[model samples]
Target: MKMSNLAVDICGVKLKNPIIAASGTFGFGEAFTSYMDISRIGAITVTGITLEPRLGNPPPRIAETPSGILNSVGLQNPGINYFLDAELPELRKYDTAIIVNINGNTIDEYCSLARILDSHPIDLIELNISCPNVKEGGLAFGAHPDTVYEVTKAVKANTKKPLIVKLTPNTSDIRETAKAAVEAGCDGLSLINTLLGMAIDIKKRRPILANITGGLSGPAIKPIALRMVWEVAQVVDVPIVGMGGIMDGTDAVEFLLAGATGIGVGTANLVDPTACVDILDELKDYMIENKIEDIRDLIGALRI
Candidate 1:
């Protein structure tokens, strides 16, 4: 099948395929250059950027689990100036769409970052309201629908680029948050960031991660991610980028069937450097085998 068969659109941005390199995993699209052709990705959501640089959490920040990993990396990244001065220029040369994920400790900080990025050459702005590992701004603004609306509306007012709000799975009802974000003016939404969880070291009699608690990711959260995406899709007409434990083509297909316009490959990248391209190939094979031509045909095509 041709590559065009896998093309997808998120908001107004056109992706060559539905495979998006999720934030925190793809590392600004440059670190993976030696692993695979970064241009093959549909879009790249760079690491979470903040108004100021963050030292992140202490060591022992990542712990392996049965089918997943718990992480408390704490949104470690250079400040926005460094990203704009050092990273954005190099990323502009790539063929894929560029989605910058921005986070802040307050609504003003979020607006400031969006305002600064408005003049630059980016395809989209992903308002990272759902980072569970952080202490201040991320999950705090995401957990409540009212706060989600306030922050999303504030950020949307400050930028011209399409805003895609990434939602947290820790919320009581993700659909409420999704509705609030859309009502607040977000152009699109990304669901099921990471589930709140932790693990304990029996031998040491202590928590595995230094933070004691962390965000759970990988295959363990796929089912929950799909359910949230499906539930949110039923309530909103905007595009949805579904992520969490998307390790293979079959997993990507599941998200699409559940109503994700874009598929986010997170932990799979850590498991395989070429996972994005590998999954893209596998998805194409599945399409051809099923006699499906256009990739859009699979979006929201789940059979009840």
Candidate 2:
């Protein structure tokens, strides 16, 4: 299917394609530049940056499961300052849009980052509210509608750049949370930020990951991610960046049909460093075979 259109405008930022490298999987967008042309990607969501540098969790941070993996990296990063100073410059050379994923132990830290990044040249700021909220008794801000609204509102008050609130699937009703973010003034939403999961080593009689619990991601959670995306899409008016375990073009198409304006490629990168570009090709092929002239036609095209 010789196509001419693949560009998508996500929350005011233009992207060449609909596939974005999910945060945490792609580290600052520098590591994958060696394997593929980073410019070919739609956008790159950098690793989760914190207020200060962190070493992350101890060894055995990753554990392979049936069709997915458990990761307890604990948001280890070089801090936002280093990222703005060191990483941003290098990534800016790429043609794709730059979206930074940020986390904080407190609402103050989140607002601080937002205020600072608002003055930068970045395209968007994705709030990683999946992290534990120390002030709220260790619950993730994204899990509760009130916290989600408050945090989203506070961050939005400080930033002029487009804000994309990344939601957790651990909530009882993801739709309510999505609505809260939209009400709080988020420009877009990214759903299914790794389901809570764990694995055990029988012989050792202990948990496989040192953190005891971790985020499960890969093809195993694609179905759940799709459902959440569909649910949120039905309730909210903001764009949804759906992600979970998208590995191929067919998987990417499924997300678009589920009402995702943009697709996030996560574990696929670990499986194949060139997965982003490869999936873009597959998406084009799928569109061609399906007689789809424009990729945007696939968004929310699912029939009941």
Candidate 3:
């Protein structure tokens, strides 16, 4: 079958394939270009960007679990201005869609970043609502439906580009936040951000991560990610980008079957720089073996 059959669209943004390099792992797509052809993958969601540059957490911010890793990277980036001026121009030369992942400490900061990116040539805006809300007593904006709606609506109003809200899994009900985002005018949703977890340094008699806790990701979280994506897909009418512990082509297929219109490869990238394209190739092979004509046929095709 032709590779063109792998094409898929997310929130009106066309991707060559359903495989997207998940945020924070791909590092703006430039780092992987040396390992493989970056253009072969679908879209690229750069590292989480803030209004200002961050020094990130102190040392020992990452620890390896049985099948995954815990990370408290603290949203370190060169800030949006540096990204637009230094990174985005080079990223534009590539053939994949550019999804800028933006984070803010307050609602107004989110809105301001949206307005600033509105005039840029980026293909999509992914709101990283997992960031702590400074104005709301240090709670993540995505933890509650009300705050999710408030931030989604505020950011939506400030930008004309298609907005994709990345939902945090550290909530009581993931479905509610998904519904809240769509109701507030979000064009699409990405589910199953890292689950709250930590590692203890048994020898050191202390927590491994400096923050005492971090986001857990890897094959260990795939089951939870798939369940959340399937649940959210049942309730929301918008497109869903499913990510978490996706380490290979089979993992990507599972997410697609679970109702992800787009598959996000996260921890897998850190394991292998060429993981995105490799997963895309494996997905194409799966389609050929299954005689699937189009990649869209796999979306929500799970046997219930």
RMSD of each: 1.0, 1.6, 1.7
Per-candidate local distance difference test: 0.94, 0.89, 0.88
- Better model by lDDT, 1 or 2? 1
* Candidate 1 vs 3: which has more TM-score: 1
The digit string of per-residue lDDT tens for model 1 on 1-304 reads 4543788889999999999999999888887899899999999999999999989999799999989999999999999999999999999898999999999999999999999999999999999999988889999999999999999999999999999999999889999999999999999999879899989989999999998999999999899999999999999999999999999999999999999999999999999999999999999889988989898999999999
Candidate 3 global TM-score: 0.97
Task: Report how far off residue 41 is in candidate 1 (Å).
Answer: 0.3
Which segments of model 2 are wrong by more than 4 Å?
A: 132-139
Residue pairs in candidate 2 whose N, alpha carbon or C atoms collide under 3 angstroms = none
Q: Any idea what lDDT model 3 has?
A: 0.88
Q: Is candidate 1 or candidate 3 better by lDDT?
A: 1
Rank the models by lDDT, top first.
1, 2, 3
Best-matching candidate per TM-score: 1
Cα deviation of 36 in candidate 1 (Å)?
Answer: 0.8
**Stretches > 4 Å off in candidate 1:** 1-4
Q: Output the worst ten-in-a-row residue range by lDDT, candidate 1.
A: 1-10
Model 3 spans > 4 angstroms off: 1-4, 131-139
- Tens-place lDDT digits, model 3, residues 260-302: 9989999999999988888888888888888888888889999
Ordered list by TM-score, greatest first: 1, 2, 3
